[model samples]
Target: MILVIGGTGTTGRIVAAKLAERGHPTRIASRHPSTEGVRFDWYDPTTHPDALRDVRAIYAIPPVGEVDPAPIMLPFLERARSAGVRRVVLLSSSAIGPAGHGLGMVHARLGELFVQWAVLRPSWFMENFVGEQPHAVSAREQGEIVSATGTARVGFVDPADIAEVAVRALTDPTPHNTDHLITGPEALSYDEIAAVLSEVSGRPVKHRAIDPVGLAARHTANGIPPDFARFLASLDTAIAAGAEDRTTSTVADVTGRTPRTFRDFCRDRLRGDRPG
Candidate 1:
């Protein structure tokens, strides 16, 4: 059976659905057991064994931000190995570094584990456009998207494609112990993204530049916690410094199809109904 952590989340939900559709017994593990799935909590180690029981494959979605996920991930890996799990797929970030915080530590360590593993290092998800990022939706309603990034272009990937690649990796299980740097087809700036959103939504949305600290405050004012708000603003600063301005073919390379373009994402998400 396949167990998907964060199964109700963006990528995990899609992966679990696809796996189930393919005749695999998929179990979803998360803090909320309200759904018809396994109830598991990362903070509660006692629940881990019950969740890992008879599981052969796992989709690991570590907690967000630069927090230490090793304590959670390492135990899961050790237990999976002990339980005779065959395959494990981990969702990693492109921004992760060997010495950086957050998923970076987990990503680096997952590489050394004595099991068949695949790490997906994807760029900023297209979901951020309509779901996560306040600027994108605000732009649709208020006609202006603000960012600290000016000209830096990012190959914003779709979580759907990331899930597709992840599903393939989980079921197929070839070329094990490899990291895939997934990215969209083209790189575009927030200016271009605003234009696409405007066209898709039939609004006059524009991109506005804001100072990093000011953006941080705005994020907190909009409900993000202070520390996470500062971290997000720092990420924008990283973007402005050209940290995430690269493109890659890994998405297509793994999925046997081209990654979805931002325009495609805009049409499907910004214009059409999927989910928030």
Candidate 2:
């Protein structure tokens, strides 16, 4: 059976659905127990045992709100290994290296523990414009997308692409045992993203670059912890330094198909209407 951690989330939900469509024995793990899955919280060890029962493979999405997730994840992964789980596919970020902080540490550890593992280091999700994040959606509504990224570009990948790659990694007999730098078809700046939103939504949209201090203060006001807020702001600062402006072919190589472009995403999710 395949255990999909964070299965109700953006990429996880799609991964679970695709596995189900393929007639794979799949179990979804979430914080809340549901008819569809079991309650599995990484911070809570009691839930881990039940979630790992009869599961052979896992799609692991680390717990949110923790900058350094190794403390919370390493123990559970050790338990999973003990439980006879062999394969693991981790959802990580493209910006973080194997020895870097946060999820990078988790990625490094995964390689040490499991031979049957693939780390998906995907670029920023295109869903950030149309999904839960306020910046891009607010741009469609209020004509301005605010960011600390300045004019830097990102190869914004689609969540569907990430899910597809995750499924391949989970089911493949031979493990990749390497990091796949997943990206969209092209790199684009926030200014260009705003222009695309304007064309797709038929609205006048603009990109507004903010200072890191102001961005941190805004996140703090929205109830995020000070340290994490600063960390998030720093990501944008890195982007402004030209950190995330590259594309890769790993998506196509892994999934046997080209990754979707930002234009394709806008056409499907943003065309002829305001972002929800």
lDDT of 1 by residue, 143-212 (tens): 7988898878888998989999898888883645788888888888999988887778777778888999
Q: Residue 240 deviation, candidate 1, in Å?
A: 1.0
Number of clashes in every candidate structure? 1, 0
List per-prediction Cα lDDT, in the order shown. 0.82, 0.89
Tens-digit lDDT track of model 2 for 79-101:
88999999899998887888756
Q: Candidate 2: list runs displaced more than 4 Å.
A: 272-276
